[model samples]
Target chain A: MSVVSDRVTALVPSQWWQRSHELLSRVFEDDRRLLALCLTPALALYVLVAILPMVWAFNLSLYEVSTLNPVWEWTGPGRLLDIVASGTFQAAFGRSLVFGFGSVAFQIVVGVSLALLVNREFKGAVLARALALLPYMVPAVAIGMVGQFMLNAQYGIINLVLIRVGILNNPVAFLGLPETAMATVMVVGSWKFAVFVTLLTLARLQSIPENFYEGATMCGANAYQKFRDVTLPRIKNVILIAALLRTLWMFNKFDIIYIMTRGGPGETTTTIPLHAYEVAFNQYRLGEAAGIAALMFVFLALWSIVYFRVARPEEEVRVA
Target chain B: MTDIQVDTLRKEFSSDGGEIVAVDDVSFTVEDGEFVCIVGPSGCGKTTLLRCIAGLEHPTSGEITLGGEAVTDVPPQNRNLAFVFQDITLYPHMKVWENIAYPLKLDGVGADTRYERAQEVADTIQIGELLDKYPGELSGGQQQRVAIGRSIIRSPRAYLLDEPMSDLDAKLKKEMRVELQRIQQQVGGTMVYVTHDQEEAMTLSDRMIVMDDGEIQQFGSPQRVYHEPNNVFVSQFIGSPEINLLPATCRDGATVAVDDTDWRVDTGVDADSVPESVTLGFRPRHTTVERTADPDGIGGEVALVEAVGDENILYIDSEVGELRAVADIEQNPIEEGDSVAIGVERAYLFDAETGETVATSRRHGDRSEDQVEA
Candidate 1:
């Protein structure tokens, strides 16, 4: 036993390391124990960064708190419930639905179309595919700033080109009007992120074997029919997963909207996240903002559950 | 069903490296309701030729006609041809019945009618029970059956199969080969099949097109190709153990000196037309081997013996080259490490420089019984 221990010690440079290594080996012999050990670091990080904040916010929602003064007044669920039922929160929720779902749908359609276009075999196709994903790498702040400059009614190049092309007789203040502010914000906000869908959809598209199309052709399927049978079913799962991720991100997206419209044009573009921000900083109502954030979290969790149940996005795409 | 006529079809693919001539001025004709197979080594343009006929590939300079209707510029779907790929490409998301009914669905057939036709096809191909299962759940042979069922369901003008059975195991391949032949006869559709396996081509096709280097080496019945190979490549390619080839020189009208000059095979050609240097060819089944103390004939040692059912395939290491000879195991029990003498009862002489056939000992029309051994 002494010799065996000595050999084990010699395998490692230090006695403490050897003892720990032996302990790890013994613990890893059980599959459940090994899995728990592997997940400990990530679980700890998630609890600290995500779960703890959510729990703190939920606790804060039940009490009336102010950031200016560190005093908390005991309040029941009445205030939180009242804030949820208020017209401001209802309008913000409706706006978020429009923005989030609209952006996701637009991204999926354009991204899949772009992927299909670039998937063809031609000269410089590889370079074209690489260039197509460049937009996704641009910073959100840069897109917001550039969008503001381009949509400027007086001196923007877009207005100049539109006037020269006779599409628009006059320069329109795109983000300064109530009717166009939300639409403009949505399009600009989703510009850089649409290629996230493209990135994944393109990967799935490339993995599909060329023979599938050839087989479809032999089955008397026209071009649209080929896409419907061969391309769509293969990319359906990918598109669903991409839409789910994009919906979550767009719903919680704060930077681009805050930078472009600032929930502006008479509260036209105020989404749920922006509403929560305004409640905290503008109204100095920390407890109300925490309530809104907590509600958003619960809504997203429920939405994700339903999305998974209905869409059934698979982790691995099967090719036949 | 319509016959296909390919007139001087050629296909060239240009890559970054250079231009590749996949099918170089190939021409052939497939009669109505006939099963013709294009067989060759890999990259020999047999698959390309089949693709050209199916309209999956466009020839660089040629015209293709189906029943005398020119379809050179037609798309694959418009050409009304069914193709079975070598990989057995069945849509994974679709059930077996849906895959068989895909063409009818494309034609706007009602779901009930499509299912009825699919059921008929599935029963015909012996896949009736697998109609509800997806392609991912089926075995390789079952997937192949589903593919074939899909092809025959449409009753297209012709069917082109590109090495369809090449992925199956030996036993499964034989079974599918018979099933395909029966389906072809029942459907009576013009079929153009491509394969690199010579045995598959021989057993399945009514006429076989043997190709090499983007050109047709020979196109005839399997028996004619086996007995009267036009060149060295065809003879060596079509046989199982491969034909035995030895370098020789025709000394005169009657005599042809073999490998070591001491051994001579009698030539059955006229002296004036015979080439000087030639390649003597004989099939392993036709060549005879006996244990001999006298070394007047071509002498060799049996290096290996493969007992294949009733016959033994002997691998002989001779003075000139390694020779393959087949023998009846029960009548002549040959073993490894035995010294033997070989006799060529029938032989073909090919021009050595050009690898073209010059003469054969037996005339083409005279089919008679011959002695098996000397």
Candidate 2:
């Protein structure tokens, strides 16, 4: 290992390395130039990937274009207005709200609970924490498949167990029924992402000192009171930030829902992402699909700005 | 207000090496409204004992009682004790008033009433203007005052402070020590304070418990612990600048032969009655020094002259070891490398094997060791 490390070190030219170090130090000596040098790559990448694509989509939204026709016709903002006023678009937006809110709520509740549970000291606490994060590491395709198998009407363990325990007289076709399809897909879509919340909440929870609880105890606070006074305040900002990210991801979520229900038992789980996919691919009207995508981008950007302005989660870091 | 009685408390913590006894069969009492300071070196179980009394740490065996009620089984919250942690754990998110009135809020007090009470408590602790600011916005001393305000808000049965001012600078520590004493007097509550600083323990405590190795060496008033130390450890640990110890052995005619020197310590008692092997302890203040070339007296060269306030403490490098002797800075006019003769005006004779004080001199140049024994 020592010989290999020495050889690795020897691979770099000594004078060239010294020259580069000197050059870097000289460049970093100027604050404005250093700031520009540090930020340029990230800024360039963001513009290329995110900003350019969004601008292209917005420009595409102004024209009536189709893959089938190989022709573009200038239709202006009338096409965007028509897409927005359509019943299909309105229904998809409502479903997006339901799935987004439901998944975020479920994730926060389960994630914070899991974080609290695994934060304790026990015999196999390290193993338990690792196991709790295992779901998040699993691929989205595998999550959808496993979710489908578990919720199967015929041989699914869930229906069988519920029927065996006599809670249901019949095995319910969870995905086949429009009433349960959206709810089921929302849960499955949120399963892996909930661990993301757990990871953030746990990191924040661990940073809270043990003396805070002891101080609370000395202040005559009971178990519930301690949680409200000490634990909740410390973890509040992390939970809020997690919920914001989860809501954004859930709003634009497509893969797991597509894999499981494929826009539903008759459009039940068809969120904004699924609607845009169907409009772009199935209908082959690229302009309208781009219009829908552009609307989503604007909505999410506005929502993020509003959420940050209202919540002020940054105050926690300042106070801490 | 309640007196805390800890009876034969023993706390053992298991580590890879084995069981470590943190508090070893210790027992003491803090009378109602009295401030008792438990003083010790680090890891001496002083903090553990205070936590045990507050019911934060469960004892492996024995009991603690508050106002004649056993609280060993009770949780810390139910014990109604206010604890100021050594680290000064003020809630960072809460404003000063909210942190102060958290206990009242927990007790189902309304916001308006609790805020009013918090403001009053904050004012009493000299943090009235900081009520609207968060803990992170305050300095270390202000944060400590907020922590103290939180503890004193509800007037718990007793206050347990574990080196609350240890994190402050020397100037801030002195200021807070006086502020804490004033608050204790104003509240008139029983307090069990733990600190490693001997000066803090001496000045702030009604009675101080000097501990080492999970056991109390002596427990008494500061003056008593200073002048009448129960053992060598207490004598060395209690006094600032530390007490100097020299090895000596009993000789003929009520005298003890000092180490490798012709100097003799008159025990003021029968020489045969004194232990054959003994240790002599004398504080720097009790020790006297003179410029002399006499071979019969203890001789040393002053290595360092430390001028502290009105007195100059001379660190003498002698034949036996380094000895400390204090003198009036103006009168002594001492300098480094100056040869001086050292004398013990009042000294303590400790048993060499056990480190227990055998006898103590009663007065200046009046060595009546037998008088102390009687």
Candidate 3:
């Protein structure tokens, strides 16, 4: 006991250990007194809200948890297999992957291009940047509302323009058609979130040293070559991080698409979140919804690992 | 080798309120294969002048000629002049190999040739093993070498180095000084170097251009400029511990009355051209001090004795206020609070009113005629 106390005391700074070193640390041996005191309130809330729910849902996946039916039937893990094999869940999973990745890809490309273009000084640059930020700053629900009006089949401005231009004899059903519903929602989502990537890329771009460009100029590089050699390499790291964040946000995105196309003209854009919602609320199959949510959690965890490993966005960037 | 000349070059910049003339009608010429240094205090337009010579800056109303062709209107790319900036501006992204090869790649060179030339330049700079490392991984000095390597990969008309050694430690700076001199000798171009360090200017330059207030005070060989300063500013600026100035008047054709002493003036000033009032300038090495009360010399008291490794500098208080003198530590030892007598052996006289040189001590050994009537 004496040896342990002496070692513990040695670990602390001498000045601090010199004063008030005994009573405060007697708790280290059976430190549960203070540990339990410090850990009670926050731990209670987390367990009740987070841990308990997740554990219950995992256990609930093995039984029939129904709201309308009174009888509880033990189905074991077969419930999860049933949810996975359902055609609607499969379509929702595939559609979520397409909407999440496809929109985020276009967002990255457009975002980085705009960031590079606006990084330079010119007349009205500040005003133009502020104007470009309006689309991203607007609420996503409002943007979806506006997108529905414009993408309407009959009298929408898009169809009106196409009709006026005489390119199409008939107005295309952008939201009602299964083929174009997912793509329309993707275009709208990318339009709304592209500013996030632009801001991130631009911040990193501005941090790059001006002397690098001057050195390139001295080496006889033109404006375009300077961008290719110096600017692109410096900002690509932040673009990787921005793309990852956007993809994660879009993967579980439900509200914007739900308001715009509502699982789209026969489930063309029913993402994982929407499917989980329909199962829990409409069908009242609580156990199947839990299973679907659990699967999504697994897939997201695997995705995050693979994406971070592949991107490795921690490229060396000089501070000065 | 290239013959570069600036015909009354000037540069101006507009600030918030008005135009600021950075280089005020500066003109000089760099001979082929000559190493010239432009040295001045900060904000004295030495770097601006070098930038103009590199065609990075456009002159306000002047012309620059390279190889007997007017290149004032030529862009820097067309001028074919290379510049090494003060800061080591290596690309932080590329490896040392690609950074050195980037310039050749921009000129549309093939990948194989670019790789070969980059490796050769990397070997010249002695960074072969570190070629695969990014600049962020290199030390400040290594990055500086990469910058120089990038500049020297191509044979530009002339190399303009802008205080490229200012960012090194003292010992490292000395080492890199030798490295730079060796590289310059090997490359053998008309290199125009800019530095505010007069010691560096003196050591590295074949011909030095001393500037102040956007004007050239003196342009000559380092030996000639150090021994015979053309004006009081040049005299005080070119040396450490500073030159001492004494107020004097030309009493007659062959003598000058300085303070309470009348001394024979043997400076090369012709008797007919000698001005009435002058300031006598002498270097610390020229001022000899004796630790005794000698009637023939001005009496002084030693205020401080500073030992500077190889020599000692004595700060003596006399009728001229504080005067600095140097002594060889091996021959004569000095101490504080010693009564001393001061005498100047070599003196440079300048016209007090015009601030121009009226006479210089005869060290050139070329001007044999003594216009001093004695």
Candidate 4:
């Protein structure tokens, strides 16, 4: 232990040794005292907020605890494995995947189309861009409430307009049916996230040198050819980054989904995060909740790895 | 091969400020298989004129007839002309092969023929190994070669190049200029090039149109433009270290008083035509430097000496007011503050007000008999 400690101490730098020697002789040195003063708050915050909670959560995930009797018994990694293998937990995990992928796909399509629409030099384009960003700027809870109001079955504006336009014979319960419920959540999530993607794509489009398109036109390439050959390839990296971020955000989304559907009309909208919340607060199953949280943490870590691998910029890839 | 005849081409851009006349009533003709360079200062509408010929920009009024067919409203692609830009506007996302093959593909050429022709062009521009690389992966010079390759593969009626070599370094520019001339000769197409560099125009063109302020100042062969300029602007713009102009009053017949010195200069104009004030233009090479005691010359102290390795340039503050003279390196050296005499020969005189060349005369002309006392 002493040898290992000495090796670790060597990496702390020579200044630490000098300061330690000085402190041993006197209790303070000017440089060492100043360094301590600067690092104290940051170290305290790290220990209290980051390290303590992580350690506590890790410890809690290894126990069995129930709500009825406020007691816990140590069970090693048994509970973590049990939760991973359970059908309900697996279903919730699949639902989370659906939510993430469904939202990201819709967002990329709508976002790229919207960006292209506003990319041209036309009248009222600025207004269109500002209106498109309204969904992103609204608070998540507000967005959920707005979606609920608009998608309401009886008195909703959407249904009213559809009935008046003769597109529907009866008002549809958009958030009630299981299939339609998941689809509605995905659509709402995408609507909210599309603004960020559009902004990212617009920035990428602006950075592409104008000469590229002009050269394409001069080379006998029409509008579609220019977009396919020049604009798309130039902004592919930015699009990937935007998609990755949207996927991560959609995977962890809770407030919007909770407010809109409350994981109701069955477990159709009960994603992994919603399941974790129900276990921790409603059922008071502390150990199971911690296990769910740990599973979510692992899933996100794997996803991030995949994202980095697939979304790496072209410059990082070797060209043949 | 096809001839390009631009008859009174004019273009006016409507900016928020007002109407900016970019190309104003420009008229010229380029014969089949001939290379013509439109040389001008910046903002003189040289690029606009090239774009007009390429059908990239519409003329406000005028007709561009190619092969006796009016092409005023024709689109660029339909006009069958290719343009090479100064910025080397290669599609950064496309590989060199795709870039060079784009025009052929647009014309519905088969895949095999397109690739084969692209390879042939790639070999011509010496970018065969870089065919698969994207434009962003290549250097500026390589990208420019790819751009040229793209144009040449189309076998367009005429090629419009707007300052294509302006972005290259000095050494590369020189090498590419030689290669470009060779390519033009090999293709034998009517080529219209625009550049601000007179040396490039002189080196590469069969004829050049020198323009300034949206008007053609002179249109002639490079040799004619150099030895006999139509106006003061061409005289100043065509040569390195510009020709020097001195104020002179056309006194009694063919005799002009240059400042306090009297010179017997034949106007070469009709005997009846004499202007009150005329400007005397002489190239630095036309002025000879001599010792201070030499007779039959204007003398002054040397202001500056510029050593250009192969030749030397002496700035003399002589009686004609700061004359620039080019002398051989092997000649006797003249340092700053050294008094020297300059003898002018084969000088041109321009009407001072109009800046138009009035006459040119050799040193020993009929006017020499009216020699005046200094």
Off by over 4 Å in 3: A1-63, A69-74, A123-136, A149-180, A318-320, B58-61, B68-74, B108-112, B132-137, B246-268, B271-278, B294-299, B351-354, B363-374
Reference-based TM-score, model 1:
0.95
Which CAPRI level is candidate 3? acceptable
lDDT measured at residue A257 in model 4 versus the true structure, 0 to 100: 85
- TM-score for each of the candidates: 0.95, 0.94, 0.84, 0.85
lDDT of predicted model 4: 0.83
Model 1 ranges with Cα > 4 A deviation: A1-34, A315-319, B267-271, B363-374
Ranking by TM-score: 1, 2, 4, 3
Cα deviation of B347, candidate 3, in Å? 2.8
lDDT of 4 by residue, B178-210 (tens): 989888888888999999999999999888889
Best by DockQ: 1
When 2 and 3 are scored with TM-score, the better candidate is: 2
Model 3 residue B12 lDDT score: 95
**With candidate 1 superimposed using the best TM-score fit, by how many Å does residue A119's alpha carbon deviate from the native?**
1.3
lDDT of 2: 0.88
List where candidate 2 sits over 4 angstroms from the true fold: A1-22, A317-320, B260-262, B269-273, B364-374
lDDT of each: 0.89, 0.88, 0.83, 0.83
lDDT (C-alpha) at residue B252 in model 3: 72
The sequence of per-residue lDDT tens digits that candidate 4 reaches over residues A155-232 is 899889999999999999899988799999889867878889999999888777776676677777778877887788
Q: In model 2, how well does chain A match by TM-score?
A: 0.92
Best by lDDT: 1
lDDT of 1 by residue, A140-227 (tens): 9999999999999988888899999999999999999999999889888886788888899899899998988999999989999999
